[model samples]
Target chain A: MNALAARRRHPAAIAILLLLGLVAVGGAYSLLAPKQAQASVVSAGDINTGKSLFLANCATCHGMNAQGSAAGPTLVGVGAASVDFQVGTGRMPLAAPNVQAQRQDTSQFTQEQIANMAAWVASLAPGPAIPGAQYTSGQNADVAQGGEIFRINCAQCHNYAGSGGALSRGKYAPSLTGSSGKTIYEAMLTGPQSMPVFSDSNISAQNKNNIIAYLKTTQTEQQVGGMTLGNLGPVSEGMFIWIFGLGLMLGCAFWLGQKAA
Target chain B: MTDLDTTGQPSTDVVHLDEGHHIGTGGLPARFEDPGLPTHIHRMADDSPDAGRRAERQVVALFGLSMLATLVFIVAYFAIDKSVGIFLPGIGSTNALNVVLGVTMGISLFGIGAGAVHWAKTLMPDTEVVEERHPQASDAATRSAAVGIILGGGEQAQLGRRPMIKYALGGALGLFALPFVVQVAGSLGNPTKALAGLRSNLWDIAPGVSPIRLMRDPEMTPIKASDVTIGSVFHVMPETLKDSQHVLEDKGKAAVILMRLDPNQFSAAAGGQRAQAWGYQGIIAYSKICTHVGCPVGLYEQQTHHLLCPCHQSTYDATNNMEVIFGPAKRALPQLKITVDDAGYLVAPEGFHEPVGPSFWER
Candidate 1:
């Protein structure tokens, strides 16, 4: 006790104490931290194939080690979900460097190939994984609650109907009409392009499923009011009334005012 | 008729001609004669008895059709279910009840109108007639009498003789509007008091009290620092809002958008350092009300780090202390200085230094 009290005044004592404290915290955190669920299991062979494919296709923009270059951002910690959303949606391996990447109808890679790349990216660092089927499926979701959540969080950018809207500098929030349940989940998890992330911590898995269910219900629901005018809301409806409705009235007036033959 | 001179004055030289005289003899007609209406053309209903009978039958049929349509409308209104969906050829899906009600009502009205029109055009008189228009102004004697009556009424009131009463009445009538003006203006409230109210919001922590927790909007759940991840955005409100007298008004002023980004991503040239210092780690909070026109600036683009107001497209760089990068926003969004509490939940240690929302006169 006398030696310890004397050493406490030493110059290196504070540094030693801080280092010991950091080590203890790190060890405790590793043991106590919640485990990240692995949505899919990837083999050693899958990682090797993904590495080879990435080298041949992506090494030009991204460095051989997937480090960022002047042309592209680094994919070090951008998880498997990001890769799946980007590659699976055919938004990456970009056609050209524009304001934003456009989603293509068909992807360049198969599901297995995309999975392999996701595995390789996941191995690089701790990041979000592809969501499991239980969370991705919209079954047993509360559409009404999901609608409230969507309006608060998503309606500002994506529009009230999820029909997409324009952003600044040629960017846009894409429509969620035909997006698959898996794609929707991954997009929320990854936050591709201009979209902000809605991680599991921010929006729970069940809430996300509810949102998916609501979106799906919108696609299938009958438009009871007849013509939707492209579902672009009041602006389009107003313009239609101004043009067609007024034009028809004007035509009728002209016909009515004409002298009988 | 007299001819006008080039100077627009009536000339003394004038010539009048008889009714049958031609203008070739150098005489002007005294007046223009009115042209009579054209020869009447008779319709089949007017000339033939069978055609008249047929027209009468057609009118009766239209009236009968109107009665039938009214009956249909009443029956359909009671029979059709409100929830039943019907397919329209051009309009697609629609409510069966609405369509039926609208169509039946339209047909019933149309039948009556058409019946009345057909009865008038075919069976009733189709002859054209003219009626002369009378002069709009009153005669000089009548106008003079009206003016005299008004002047006599004014004299009877003693308005001219009683100077004191005249001026007093005038002043009373003129000043009578003051109360109304004052009431209306007072109802608008004091602008300075309103501006003072705007200066503080739900985030303002009272002295000697603990800092306010940042709760998730709508859900009102308390947020933890760990819950916010990189590129994730959260709609937040101060926990003090639970006790607010005017929840909507307080919420409008205190609503915030919280976002986390990579600390290194903040640009040094745009007040990014100060923004980072005010935040806890990379999680920063800013007033959601737009600096332009008080719109909710809710569109947060993660990669571009831009917060675009859906109204007016006022874009703010979220990483650069909410600096206006594009559109008409005049100033940066006010940042809320935040810190983590002992329980690791995000809390606002202090309210915004500047008034939030759009610029007002006092600001």
Candidate 2:
């Protein structure tokens, strides 16, 4: 005990004790802590390629380390789904800085290039991943249930028919008319700009597929009634009636007022 | 009559009426010679018997067409299947039954109208008649007589003779409206009581009672802190709401929007700091009711941390203590002080400090 007490006063003793404690805690944590769920297995070579691609193409605005700069937000934990949504949808490599990034018909990068970039971003931290094909396919999904979920959660901004709507400032919820099922899944998973994230826990994969199915059904569904009047509900219908219907009435009245030939 | 020149000067020429002409009381001619209607032009049917017979046949044909259209309408109603769709050139795809029924009905109504109008123009009397219009107002004596009769009736009832009866009747008639006024006012209930109800919600915990757990809206499942990830939003309601008698009413004031954001994202200002301190880790909850016009502010932009009310476009900065960043909302959205319970489920230890939703006079 006297020998240990003498050694305890040594300057290196405290450092040794702290090191031992750290190792013990780290070892225990590694052994007992729950493992983070990874969406897919990615190789180190893919990650390296992704880093190189990011550094070459995105480093100007996102910084060399992916830390945010004055012009762009930090992409450290934004995840692979975010990259897929932004790059896959051609919203990134922004044409120019504006209120919001617009979706383009053709993406700047190919699918393989986007995957490499997503892998690199995913390596930085844990986040949402690109959803599986089963969940995004919208095959055999319950359209009715999906419709109910959509009405309660997404109808406010996306419109009842997914026609899109205006937001504050210059922002807007883009129309979902021709969006791919994969793009829709990623957008919901990542909650890209001006959109709230509906996490996997909030809306299960099955339900998300259901929502996709409902969207697809609506896009393909034929309008049973005559003219939809732009599907703007009562406002456009009212305007059409006022301009065309009333004009027809006025024309008939004028014809009646004329003397018979 | 005097003629005025274009140069703004009256001309010397003056025309006068004949001395034999008589003036009425109002300085108008007492009588004017009738100017007969313009010479009637004979129609083809009016000039020839064969043409008249042809006109009759045409009218009968229009009437017969109307009857045929009516019969077609009945047949289409029974024969056409409701589910069948047809492609129209301009209208696109439409229900076959609806189109057929509408067309038949329109034709049926148009035939009758056209047949009657054609008969009147070609076969009926073509001569025009003149009808004179009299003045609209009654003469002065007749109007005075009406007033006198009303006054005499009142006198017969002793309304004028007895001042007390006249005044009493007026008071009684005026007071008769009090019941209706009272009924309307009473139906509105007490404003103070209603305000008190609005001020508190299901989150309110009495002393010694356990805090209320935040449950998922619609699903009513309790949420653990770990389930909430950064950038995720949850629609929440107090667990106590499930057992309440007035579920919808309580839900209106108690509905909350729970969101998880990075801790570093919160502003360093006092409001932001307070918001952070009141939250659990990076998760924060706020009343979903907009401080504008009581709309459910559900449009949450995860990147911008902006909560937008679908109505009125009221935008609230979620990272800045729910401050009003834009729109007509006068105040910030009230934050709900949330913390996890023993089970790690999110709970509200206390209720909102102020009322939720749009401001009222009492607030």
Candidate 3:
């Protein structure tokens, strides 16, 4: 009876052992593999097309090899993500260099052309890749968590309400109320202009989603207790109340006194 | 009362005052007319006994409603679950407790005001009397007369004689003033506790125990010295902060900005020696909070090594021990002394030597 029971359990135990072995082998392979092997797959955009696009649009400032010149900084390691964000948002191919680069309404290159140029620049050296389209989708966004994260990280430059505020010199954090999800996410990933880069390790994909959700909610929500007064905060609100609201009331009181007499 | 004619001329409405002639200016006409107030109209409650009684009952009912509303406010303060919400027609969902408290409090105040106003308009004295203006300073006889009138007025109002009114007014006034005092006293917590809270943050290094490792802000990952490249900045916090209950409060005081700068860039005159001794391989950490008003000093101009506070435009020179370069800051940001452990993780051997953040720490 004991021999029969042992033989029956042997097959089940062997199957479990085989599964564990397979997992261990896969884990080992992933750990031991070189980083370049994985990176090559992501950087496989057509080199010829990328080079031509870069030369036509970006070579005037970025140089023939996408290297640094007197006009602009090197695009060598800025990556496909940076190129997509800059050119895609019309912030690059800058309209005459000033204190800061401003976002324009029209893009000089098509989305495909921008991608090809970004690929060429990224081919020089491995860097951050373009985030997926679903990265900014409000599907799994958590507004409460996003609000907390935004307050911790972005509220310093962007106002609490995302109305944006002044930075050093002439540069300012642009308002997010009218910004699309792609613009907000791309801005965070790329840093663009004076803004600091928030890496995947720093914010994570889920955190970015949360921030986008929070921004959307803030944009949609109505300001309670009447006027927002430009959302510049209490100083402006106080001035309006004292100068306009109180002044009107005082004028009415004077008129009533004159009528009574 | 002044009445105008069809031709817009002043008529019987203009009445001359006897006192105006004596008070006339030397060069001007010795005549002046008194502009009297509008004629008084009697309310129904003032003339009819039944209407007066009805108005008195209505005032009592309003006061009763006010008392009931005050009871509701008191109950709502403690009994209601603050997080719950209620839905109403035409209006979206809102905090139930807030609505209840606000409505009850408003009605309580409004009832008192409305009751007092209604009493004055309908039941109180209706006759209109005018008094001539007099000089501010009074003679001895006039002062005595004023005191006598005041005493006589108190008797006429029957407030002094009515024990019920004296007790009711005393209770009402006394209770009405308590909420203000309670609000003030409750808001002001223990001063010593608050001061002590401000004195030290979450980074506590006990002797013989290992120092707290530096972790990245928000991410809370331990950082290695090799990770910091020259001209790069990392917003840092103490590793122990990960398990802290008061993460925000401690983070505010303990937040540090870690940066790696070239050793050659350090000027000899401005705390160069001290900075070199404290830092490990040109990597130094300073409190990110501004010395002016405790805003996060995040903006770093890499070329100038200047940390600027956008709130008030206060700037600090990071190259020379974070000296105040421009704007309102009175002192430098507090520096955190750090070193790498055996595992290559950056750790603080001890907490900040001085309290971090605003100039209030100096106190």
Which prediction has the highest TM-score against the true structure? Answer: 1
lDDT digits (tens) for residues A55-109 of candidate 3:
8878999888888799988888777888878887778888887887777765676
In model 1 chain A, the worst 10-residue window by lDDT is A36-45
lDDT of 3: 0.77
Q: Which stretches in model 3 have alpha-carbon errors above 4 Å?
A: A1-50, A221-230, A239-244, A254-261, B1-130, B133-199, B224-234, B242-249, B259-283, B299-305, B360-363
Q: Candidate 2 lDDT, tens digit per residue, A87-201?
A: 8788998899999999987677777778899999999998888887898988989999889778767887898889888887789999898898889999989888888888878
Number of clashes in every candidate structure?
A: 0, 0, 2
Positional deviation of A64 in candidate 3, in angstroms?
A: 3.6
List model 2 lDDT by residue over B123-216, tens digit each.
8786888678999999999999999999999989988678998888899999999999999999998988887887888888897898989988
What is the clash tally of candidate 1?
0
Task: Give the DockQ ranking, best first.
Answer: 1, 2, 3
Worst 10 residues of 3 chain A by lDDT: A35-44
Residues B107-144 of candidate 1: C-alpha lDDT, one tens digit per residue: 78877977877787787787888898999999999999
For residues B32-67, could you state the per-residue lDDT of candidate 3 as single tens digits? 546577787667776688888998998999999999
Off by over 4 Å in 2: A1-75, A106-125, A221-226, B1-73, B83-130, B135-183, B190-192
Worst 10 residues of 3 chain B by lDDT: B1-10
- Residue pairs of candidate 3 with colliding backbone atoms: B1-B13, B2-B13
